[model samples]
Target: MAERSSTMKTPLNKALAQRRSKRRYSRRSCGEGTYLGYTSGRQTVLKIPTSRKKPKSRDITNQVDPDQVALLVKKEWHLSYVTPLYQFRYTMLKTYSKELSAFLVSEKQQGQTIETGQELCFKVNISVVLGLAETNQDAETIYIQILSKQVFAAKDEAQKVVWSGLLTCINGDVDYLRSLPPEFVSLPLLCTSGPESLSALVKSWLKKTFDCCFGPICITSTNLQWLAALWTGCHPTKNIQYLKLAWTIPTQPPMDVTYKVNPQDVWKLWDSARLDDGAEDSINIEEVNSFIRGLQTHFFRHFRLDLSAGSLMRVSTALGSAHHSGKIKITSPDYMTTVLQLLTECALLKMPI
Candidate 1:
């Protein structure tokens, strides 16, 4: 019985040894360091050490110094392709006897102003809210609304605005800034809202005398007759580039809302015979076209316009038919549709590449 037991034990031990050798050979061929053994029933299996050097434990004391650590921040700028509101810097310097000191700030300083403002009310596309503007009214000083939330301003001392800077103003107001003399106002851009500003008054005065070729003009009312007047050499406002239109909506209390014309206005220009009536030379054709192109492309591209998609489809269909006939003719009772049709013709005639 003892001899038979020994014989069985010998075969079992030999089989185990053969398995271990095969594992070592396979691990070496595979280029793995070694096979860490797994559990077999209640026993734990272990791999033979390939090297005498023990694996060192991680150094718990080795750590990064707090002073040596660096913090990284990322910044972003508005893209001109995506937004029509181009970024520009306009700073204002003020001098007064009221013991107020002014500090000139960079375009970056504009952000500091907006961060400290009261409540963010209206935000169009691009806007910067400086501090607040206090206007003396009725022999009393009143804190007017956020001076320039959309317009940028420099940092001011106390709650009062000493000297201001328009880091930038977006949309239609950008056009008005072109007409202003440098460093004249609290900010570069003029107020598009409220009663006509001093700049508007000056531009209006210039328009009356026709002394200036270009002026920041405000139109209270819009009519096709005005376009005819400019075309027929009645009054030359063609040079008047920065035009702000006030749409008067009468409520319980009448209020005038200042708004830039939509891209549909470009369509209006197309329908007019003025552009084609041999009066193109008399008018600032280049300026008008340029303004139209800018409005249609950039301004329209950025802002949301409630243009009728159905109207556009119909206009496209009409244009296709006209193109095939080698003659263009579009007639529509809807004003915007008519404008669309005329624009298509103009594009074909002038902008066709």
Candidate 2:
């Protein structure tokens, strides 16, 4: 009887193993040749980019206030995607500033006593950042800064800016902007550099005021690859100093690999990857892939491990650094527009119909 029971259990275990193997194969087969596209309640699929133009260095110091530009490039900002703001107008910025200030003050004071010399006071300022819009359909960029001070501070003491945010659309998709109603403004991207609590409070106020929704936008590994290629392509005109990439490999305990390449060597590889007929101003997806492959191949020759098997977690150069978690630091102002355009595309992709 014991021998017969053992025989019966062996066949049952075998059947379960076979079923698991079949499921794994099916999942792999389905992932292949899949044409994934973004849909926003439209029958037509959005044509996402497979390639992008090389970033051209443009001196924006003369275009806007130098002080404002300094403030932007100095901080690493947290990113968010904002839906179309219903009835948002550029004319009422002053009124919006006052209202936002009051809203934040009321929120802070709730269920708390205001003690003399102990309570904090808040001030909000909103202004238009001119000359960022490329097309007429694009809305003028709005800059917001929140200043805070102690309620009993000295009269000569100045309030310090505790938070700052930018709402802008630079070279946005024309069709999507045109499709929106006149009342809706397509400032789809928001970059905030501040405490999480203040960021949440400001977002809440904007949502209540403009009937818009905000969602966190994370930079994906593929986008980081694109950024690495784009920034590397700018090496000729701009000094990238060095190229550094971070990858995470799935191992028993997870492994991290940091690969750093000399700027001159990587530039030569990028230049060689370009076709003879390829325009000097633009780079194709094929060239980008080749550049990356060249790096991975070189590393494999020495390490006997393929870096491509791991996920790219971060990419950094002298000009900027981008992480997969959506935090970015722009050290140079020349390529700010290019970065903002890519971020805008990502934000728009997050929009729900």
lDDT, each prediction: 0.21, 0.72
The candidate maximizing lDDT is 2
TM-score of 2: 0.82
Which residue pairs show collisions in model 2?
none
Per-residue CA lDDT of candidate 2, range 169-214, in tens? 9867778788889989989999999878889889999999999999
Candidate 1: clashing pairs of residues: 127-150, 128-149, 128-150, 129-149
Please give the lDDT score for candidate 2.
Answer: 0.72
Count of backbone collisions in candidate 2: 0
Candidate 2 lDDT for residue 338: 69
lDDT, residue 111, candidate 2: 42
